[model samples]
Target: MSRTPQAQTRTQTRKVRAAEPPLDVAAWRPAPFLPRSDARDPALIFVIAVLCFLACLTTLFVIAGDRAAGGWAAQLTGEATVIVRASGGETPDAAAARAAEALAGVPGVAEARALEREKAYELVRPWLGDVSDLDDLPVPRLVAVTLDRETPATGEQLTGALKAQGLDAVVDDHSVWLDDIRRAAGVVRWTGAGIFLLIAVAAGAVVAFATRAGLAARRDVVEVLHLAGAEDGYIARLFQLRFAGVAAVAGAVGAAGAALLGALLRLVGGGEGITPALPIAWIDLLAVLPCPLLAAGVAAVAARLTATRLIRDL
Candidate 1:
């Protein structure tokens, strides 16, 4: 039979196509076992982000509060005050001046000076304001004392020095105040740590719950994949990666929110965070950088554990 050249080429092409091995379409275009989008994803992200935001804020608060406590402790550690009472017809001013001189000579004392009468009155007026003869009463005067940072003088030493000079004075080295500050700082640190840990645990629990829900919702797909020889680990990893990505996005959003709030505090407070107690800084915002990573890690661990357990049971 006679045939055209085009017919011969088409016949040759069909023969070559028939001779080729079957293509593994799956290997070439492998789809994810888990769907990329889920209705619960947005809610989970929001919850995780809120937790991260709280954790980051707690960190900043601890830093600022600790710094403030340290500053206050330092001031008290390097200073003392003296109450000088006049005796033997000596005037209040004279008594204070004499006490100051004696304190100045003590070892570890940096400087001492008599506080003005008005300032001394201001200190006592709060407690004795109700007294009828407040002004007429022989109010004790104050001697301002500065101590060396390394070898600061003790209250006893200041008192002894005053006694040696025949002056009546009581020294207050602010030990009580220092102790209070130390205790407060410790409490703040411990409380902040506890809160941060709580937030992390909450985030993990959320991730675990979501993973369980996802596994339950797609039980059919999971079973098919399991029957088709997908290892439990491989199945678990899909969920782990999926939830980790969601958590990471949530963490970023939360961290950004916290950082912006912190920045606003810094800007408004102007070096002290709107109060002398907290002194937020621009560098503090850097603390949030690791939040997303931390969130992802936590979510990954939680999802992996949950998914692996559920898959094995099935």
Candidate 2:
């Protein structure tokens, strides 16, 4: 059908406008880089929080264990115990008094004192539970010996000297038990470091996975941006910002929760036993305070790398 000149002109105008583009590429604002589907994934944040929590705990435990090991090493190094036993109708008290005198005269012995019978009984009461027949026990007299600071004597030397003096006694330098404790502490420290490394890797994996998923879901948009000359850095920056924000919030929550738990444990335990052994220095608090920031940095780097790689591949 033939149309009027004005009608033909209107139809031509509509066709040209339709063929040009749906929206202006130069002027139109890009939709939110992070879509609702990816942003609303609560599981990612929860997983990050859990990992951060465990990491915080592992860090604290490692620090505390290291401090405890040092404390034990320092306290046990210069100390020795001498046990004086009764022999051939001689009382333990007489034997202990003689041994204490002999130890005092020894070259490297700083001081030696025999523990009184009542004190010895009190020491055993914690394990034996207030026995009425404590006097029936064949407990040897305990002589607490302090070694000289400059010339500390070894257990063998001390034993030989005491024996030469005709004293019935044995010396315990506490080295055997201390070495075991130090070894165990070293194992714990290494184990904790391994766990912390694993957790950090897991956190990075989570962020990378989320970035890949987001990139996959928005492939068409990314293709448009790529065609429109959007650089990889720009795209990566978007992902970095989004993921870092999420990670920072989640890590803060997790770290805060762990710190509260630690505080509660210390409160309930009354700073006795294990609680007192933990590292309570201000530096420890400083170390823990930046955990959230560290997590956020990890997430940001992970997201940036993942997004850049995926975009380059595309």
Candidate 3:
């Protein structure tokens, strides 16, 4: 009983339709990147941990350096030292009295006091070593002056004003010390920047390696999917989603650990003053908190790109 031509054609069409692969309904549905329970590979976890630790250290160093520099600058600013050269056989006390009396009348002077002999000795002791028996030593009279907060004087103007008086006084404005502080702060900031750049590069390399490993592990599955006519995008997405999940989990853990360490360091209290050692202000912490998210985003993007390119080659 040979079938009619129309019946044969209809049968052949049905057979062809049946032989074709089923539409990937799973792929069409939102394929969420589910993280593997075993995704926390030891090497990858270690790398993330190290990067987080370095970042946290860098944060602490920058904060501490800035605080120290600011404190030093504040203490030194608006203050001046007047050193009076004495006439022959004139005692420092007599010269200091003359200088103090003259400075007291200066319009911008807020408080002027002749540094006591003991204070002068103490100041020089660090550098000159203890010179307790200084009765024969002819050190100039030192007067410490603090300016009114509203009436700051420039270094040159203050120096000229002091010299104009017959007191033979020289003013030291401490600019050199402030300049040193500024340089130190700059060095610390640049060092931290270098460390951060290295961390970023290392992170990218780690992500690339992880993506490659994942692809190799699932090579057979990928081949089977390709044989069944799965689109390249579909296969690449599976890898991308997996890596993104892993990166997110790692980022959270790394960030939390970094925060905890920062808090602990702050509690120890070894800074210049009573403040915490590494006092990261709330705003600073908020600013730094996004770093981990940024790192994770980079990792995810890198993984996606690497996977797509690798699959195309395969």
Candidate 4:
């Protein structure tokens, strides 16, 4: 019991060190249920991302198609065209001008004007390519006819009236052609919706399959956890969180890929035909922003359900 001052100091230091608790590795570290490799696998993420990409693309198409169809239908339904062919004794322009005058006085006719020569040339330039003798090509004259609210002048009636005025004109009601376009747009919108649904289902199935396989792969560990009084919900939550994280990242990547592809399409198409630049709107951005969250939620629900059912059976 007798010690020197230096020895006493050393003894006290040793006591203090001994009184401190030992490092607890288990408390500091979390239980490793799912392997990091399984959680980090890029294959599942890539697959999910691809599915989300397709879903996003179809969604864009659906939105754009609906808007375009409605706009076209509205514009075309109230318009008509009168084409005056060149006659032996008179030019198409003369006949078209005369026809326009006749249409101006007709009931329900709002406005009628012969299309300018330059405008007509521009319209035909796409088909004829670069041509110098465009005027000499005997191109028919075009008259744009706008309809009033009380449209009583039918295409046939306008045509007959022009014929009586010694102008060889044919009337084209845009309503007829636009009706077919609207039908086609409807088909496209429905098709896009169907494709989007299919993609979402496929994504869900993939998540479900992955979750089931993971459960089977780690059955022994799961059973040990179960034996240790770990609740089924606790175990299920692990998988749900892991898969949900994976799906969120994958869905984001997929949405970006879809946006890139859509940009490419709009660039290549040059805002022509059915492919046009998506209009900048809050609704469009809002529609796309939830994709990752939705995918993650779906994955979480699927994983949770699958894990719970399988664990219960075991």
Ranking by lDDT: 1, 2, 4, 3
lDDT of 4: 0.82
Against the reference, the lDDT scores of all candidates come to 0.91, 0.84, 0.73, 0.82
List candidate 2 segments past 4 Å from native. 1-32, 35-38, 87-89, 118-139, 148-151, 273-283
For residues 1-314, what per-residue lDDT tens digits would candidate 3 score against the true structure? 99899999999999999999999976786533334555447668667667766776677668767877777777678788888778766777988877777776777778778988877767767877766686677767789988776776666665666666666678887888989888887898899889888887788778888888878877777787789998888877776666666666666667677666666555554333226434455444444576667677777787888888888878
State which candidate has the highest TM-score.
Answer: 1
Tens-digit lDDT track of model 2 for 1-314: 89999999999999999898687678888568786445456888899989998998888778877888888876677789998898878888988988888888777888988999988778778988868988878878989999887788788888987898788788999999799879989898999989988998999999999999889988998998999999989998999988998898889878887777666655676544236567544344445677789899999999999999999998
Candidate 2's error at 271, in angstroms?
3.4
RMSD of 4: 6.9
Poorest stretch of ten by lDDT in candidate 4:
273-282
* TM-score against truth, every candidate: 0.88, 0.77, 0.78, 0.68
Model 1 agreement with the true structure over 159-184: per-residue lDDT tens digits: 78988999888889999999999999
Once fitted onto the true fold, the runs of candidate 1 whose alpha carbons sit more than 4 angstroms away are 1-28, 130-133
Residue 247, candidate 1: alpha-carbon lDDT? 95
Q: Which residue pairs in candidate 4 have backbone atoms (N, alpha carbon, C) closer than 3 angstroms, thus clashing? A: none
Error of 2 at 68 (Å): 2.5
Where is model 2 poorest over a 10-residue stretch in terms of lDDT? 279-288
Please give the TM-score that candidate 4 achieves against the real structure.
0.68
Indicate the residue-level lDDT of 93 in model 2: 92
TM-score of 1: 0.88
